[model samples]
Target: MEDTEVREVTTSAAKTNDPDGRRMQLLNYGIQTSIKKCLSAVRYARIEKVLSPIAQSSPEILKQIHKQMECQLQTNIMDEISSMFEEENISGLMNNLDKIIEETSLGPDEQAWRPSGDPSLDVLPHVYSTKLKERSSLEKILKEVEDKNRQLHEALRPRQQRLETLKKDVLKECQYWEEAAGAIPEDYKQKMEKFIRT
Candidate 1:
């Protein structure tokens, strides 16, 4: 009798654990798949944004595309996750996501929607973590480019100022010579002759 009860208990425990373990595995797989899809979409959007002449030419359109893509990805991922929840909850969540996409696509004036308050969506932050790494790398490159630009600008400033001063002096001297009966000034003529010989 004791052996039979122990076997039954063991079997029941295995049955319960199996379903939970499978559920967790499925959940993990779902999250990973969603992140991969989102990242792939982002990559495509970036490529399109870079390669398209319209996006390259107009900054406003690029910004709008960026905003729309961001909202679209978030909404897409949420909609996927909503499938795991109740039917009623799914519709409400989807409606909220649609509203958010519309608002984001329209402009910044609309009320922003966030997933931070939802505990079940914690995995979504990982998607942005990858973006943050890329952003940091890009920021480093941008800083280097900006520093080089500043150095180039600084190096050129004194030369530019000197050239401007020399040009003004030359113009004034030319005007004086012109007013003085069109004959080249003796001192200026000697400088021009020396410059030509050099």
Candidate 2:
């Protein structure tokens, strides 16, 4: 009874994870089929070589030839597997698996799967909430900084205009004084009189 129940449960789990199961099955099937095909090809090549005219009809020579063929077949299989991995770029998959293995082996205190003692350290919610909080804080800080910059610009606008006006007034006064001094009719008394009036 227990065995049947366990079998039913296993079947239900497999059904639920059908996609993962299918992927694993397909990979296994491909590897096994490739190996079988390689063996068949090697067998055919050996038979052909044995029947060929160049085949020295000696047992030792035949054995050496067969050994070379097997090595070649093994090399071909390795090449095929390597090509498959290269095409798929299995490095990322390997990295992810390594992370999973590392996580699994970590101590309870360090594992992210389990709670880390603090209520705020709950896994999924905490991670997402922390991210959201950080995002909102950044946006808030950016907005405040922009507002302060705008306020500073507004405050400086009138002061800048006032400074420009003061500069123009000073330049005009200087020019007038220069012209009046140059126009002093070679008479120091007239110049002193004008200066006293101003």
Candidate 3:
């Protein structure tokens, strides 16, 4: 406990000596953590959203995926999204990033959408549990953007298929009606013609 206290004090003093530097480092770390969590939640939420449609719809797999994200890639992914967001001059707050990105890409779900911008998955681990890096590679930076792009296209594919099926059904219905109308009674046609005031 004494050693922990001493280390914290030293860290505090170093941070106090260069507050701006500390803040920037902190901000970068925060963004990375937040984005990672956001993406993981987004991915899991996607699994949950699309389970019935996809081949493997196990909540266990979803949990495993989320756990893997937190254990391995979450920090790295968040860093990338944060760096990009900062470059775009988007605010780097993590609390809202998850929900904002979720809403931006997935639109909304009935049980989970929050008008205040909070995400639906509260069971996931807390983000922003540590400090941040001040800089990172551009190659490393754009990974999240690409991942997000892929996610959007995937989500749209099923909806597009449904639309195509609907169009085919409607066209078929029209054809059926046309064929039925062609077989109309001769008497009805004669009556319709007489209404022309022959």
Candidate 4:
């Protein structure tokens, strides 16, 4: 019989309560429960310690520590520069940004060189001429964003097309298993796994 049933019978046999006997019974039950709980808790802690490193290293466990750390570091730096995008402060940023710039010419194989426009096109429009331009309207902001998106799409077009072609080729090669149990032979089904996960 289980512990509770044994304890019930023990109490029934002792028709009268000797305070000492009742106290001892309660103490025994408490000690037994505590021991069992401690053993179970220890098992869980040991298992977690064993699995923690494996889980951390696994690619399937996305948003892992390394990626989150980089994201948080970048977010913090940008947050600290809250006022730098302002019209008056924008000129100040150009000097600091310019200092960080390293000018270099890329050879054909190096692939990084892209020159800006025709020198014969003449005068460039000056920004920060101390004449304040009004803050952009919501419509203008949306239009600028759309135009930038169009440029990004132009740059990504070939890569995106290649990705789609690659996906199709991979899918063509990958064998798709039939999921229906009805399609499986009864002899095999009894001995083998009933389902095969694709």
| Winning model by TM-score | 1
Please count the clashing residue pairs in each candidate, in the order shown. 0, 0, 4, 0
lDDT for each candidate structure: 0.69, 0.71, 0.63, 0.56
Stretches of candidate 3 exceeding 4 Å from the true structure: 1-137, 185-198
Tens digits of per-residue lDDT for model 1 on 87-167?
Answer: 555435555665666666846576655667777586666678897999999999999999999999999999999999999
Q: What's model 4's TM-score?
A: 0.20
Consecutive 10-residue window with the lowest summed lDDT within model 2: 19-28
Best by lDDT: 2
What shift in Å separates residue 106 of candidate 3 from its native position after superposition?
61
Weakest 10 consecutive residues, lDDT, candidate 3? 125-134
Query: How close to the true structure is residue 49 of candidate 3, measured as C-alpha lDDT?
Result: 70
lDDT string, candidate 3, 77-142, tens digits: 656775886787554354356456656775346465445455544423333232123234444568
Distance from true location, Cα of 34 in model 3, Å? 64
Q: What tens digits encode model 2's per-residue C-alpha lDDT throughout 169-188? A: 99999999999888876789
Error of model 2, residue 172, in angstroms: 0.5
